[model samples]
Target: MYDRLHHFYQHALALDNTPAPDKLTLHFPNDRPRKLVLDKSKLSQAEIALLNTLFHTNVAVHHQVTQENEWLYEWLINGHSPPKHKLERLTPPPLRCIHFSIKGELNEIDAFIEAIKNVFPSVTNLLWKSRTEGVLLQHLPEDTVEEELSVESIIDTLATDFLIQTSFFIGSPIDSSHLLYERFKWETTLYDAVKMTFRKKSFFYEQEIVTYYLLHHIPESTLKLVSTMLDSVMNDRELIHSIKTYLECNMNTSLAAKKMYVHRNTLQYRVDKFIEKTAIDIKQFANAAAVYLLILRLEAK
Candidate 1:
């Protein structure tokens, strides 16, 4: 008798069955030794088939007992409730969203989240409301340096330490309750933009897409000026590739040097020569933005 009850309990757990909180004792007809319960009917169809086949006797499953507190019963009758995280409940001001997508083992996903929390302790919320993809983090900026640290350093660490393929789409900071959804839309736009355009980057910002946006919208006369600005290096594929790579790497000599498989000094010399010929200081964001658009313009031409 004890073994039978134990098996039933195990089956219930395995099926994720939710029985009524207020359980009632069962009394079978014809004075049978084994008792049948109404709650067993809540078991899924597969479990019911198994029970009927295993017991070799028809269990009385037609009985439905009415309870006064139907609301609580309804709640329990649904599948087990999922544990909620802190992010599921909070909405705060001045939040920056970082949308992360992972492509590795499940443990890696948890490790990645922990790593982000450790690196950016200002993360106010870590959410997984959607079933489709990765976690969305709500980062509260403390200062300018901390805000910058959240994006670049996180990307570097995720790449250098974890070796897991990932992409982080960052949205601008927002303070108003009404503007929170705007931030989410921006994050999604950046995510799709990164996937489509900047496949090699570990993370990307919505602001970076402005260069491409300009390429599509700028007038032809303006594009000609852009082309004229970059024409000196346009025909030189090696120099062009080097300069583009340097700009893409945020003008970091060491990183660009490593990427180009050239020494730091050598990469610097190439960058200086490219700047001297083009008359554009690629180190400055404005000049880089121009050169970036010019590159796209030339490509389109």
Candidate 2:
């Protein structure tokens, strides 16, 4: 049964038998002790229900945590709101939503929640979006630098405590509670694309990744036009990388030079050469951004 199901709908089915919190699953009946899975995204609710009846079993929610928040469950599981009134009851903001993705099935959910709370003590809302993903809505503490360190600590602890890998996208603050759903949906969607495109990085910040995320969506013809801005320097790998490092270091010649292992003067000379060739002074942030995105487009190829 498993082999036949996998052969037909493997493109949409989960790789393993474990179901997502948002997916519908039919547990084994009295005749056998194995899970019967289906791709909920490809099947209507009524269609899945007929299969559930054929299997002589009832459908089950993949995880217990999702069941606790009826309103959250509706949004996450059903991919729709519970009702207008329920959504409007969200807690007041300056709340920031942090999205976490688990790499494998995690058994230490209790420990994981504790870890999140220990690092971010201001957590006001928590929900399991899927069996392997969670979200937290928290009132941010004032220490900006500390917030990043704490998120890193959570990753470290997850490796040690849960023995599973994970990543987080720390989202921008939602100034109003009413905009939570719209804002979260947008942020999470962008983070997912960025994470897929840049699989090497584990942590993503909204402010840091948004530029690349937007650039990734542009047409190739549009990218080519941006590419022309740095036409001469496109093949100069050293100069391009140095400028990228320099811009990323906030155009501080000394700092950029230190990171590039070159003298301050040498770094400035490369910067001068770049400006001379491209006629685009990267000293300004806007011009630098265009050049930066162009370099990224080249590297991606």
Candidate 3:
């Protein structure tokens, strides 16, 4: 497919009568030089469109006949010459490209390709590499679906979906040798790797996983402190409710007391005791709020 596309591009160039000019050069913002020649004029409008879509801007076509094929080599080694400016400044933001290889009947392949094109008009590169092989289509700025939901919820959905897809293929007592010990560990590792590769370039969305290793690895004493705090206030539903209400009210003792239909002094004493018992200072606001929320989340689960 790649070879056919290359051939087609060259043929298109030839057909355009723009037969690879001699010594054509392009100066980027960084004063970097990129030199290349169209071996032929076989490029299609779709291919050109794909390139434009990926770059987010039109690229000045250059044809160099005299110079050796040193443009790619120099650009890679010299780091986009001139060194002062950046290539990104001259070009558009990075884009993602999704490549598809279709085979089988020509009519069927053409229909499929057309369907994709209709949905993704920005996709420009479509090449019928061979009659029997099929077409190769490249779509820039990969598709992404966004929804209003929590990250954890998103991860859970993904995990569930994955299990459903693989469920039919596996028998009882599925193989686990290749799997990581903790599901969250696998999730985090996959998240980091995917983010590194496709997070910015592609529009496709994925969940960001948070590890609970910090909590799990904490000292036993610290764990005990958290447990003790939960147990002590576990039965004190009224106090817990009041404290939550007060915190949610921005730690305004007067407002919280009024909301709870209690005297300001009474609210103050409860708040003070909450701080003392949990070793979390409610006066500091931020830290107190974090602990308060953490407890609430844990309790809800």
Whose TM-score is greatest here? 2
**Per-residue CA lDDT of candidate 1, range 23-87, in tens?**
22233333545444334444665764565465522212212212332221222322223233422
Candidate 2: list runs displaced more than 4 Å: 1-68, 83-89, 104-107, 141-154, 218-241, 254-263, 273-281, 284-287, 297-301
Candidate 1, pairs of clashing residues: none
lDDT of each: 0.56, 0.71, 0.39
At residue 23, give the lDDT of candidate 2: 48
Candidate 1's TM-score reads 0.47
lDDT of 2 by residue, 1-301 (tens): 6556557666656433223433455555443666555556677778766775666322232344444466765564445656767766666567787888888768767777877767766786677665667777777644544434566667887788888888888888877766776777677667766666656567888788788687667788887777777878878889888999998898999999998889999999999999999899999889987787777656765
lDDT for predicted candidate 1 compared with the true structure: 0.56
TM-score of each: 0.47, 0.66, 0.27
Better of 1 and 3 by TM-score: 1
User: Could you tell me how far off, in angstroms, the CA of residue 83 lies in candidate 3 after the best superposition?
Assistant: 43
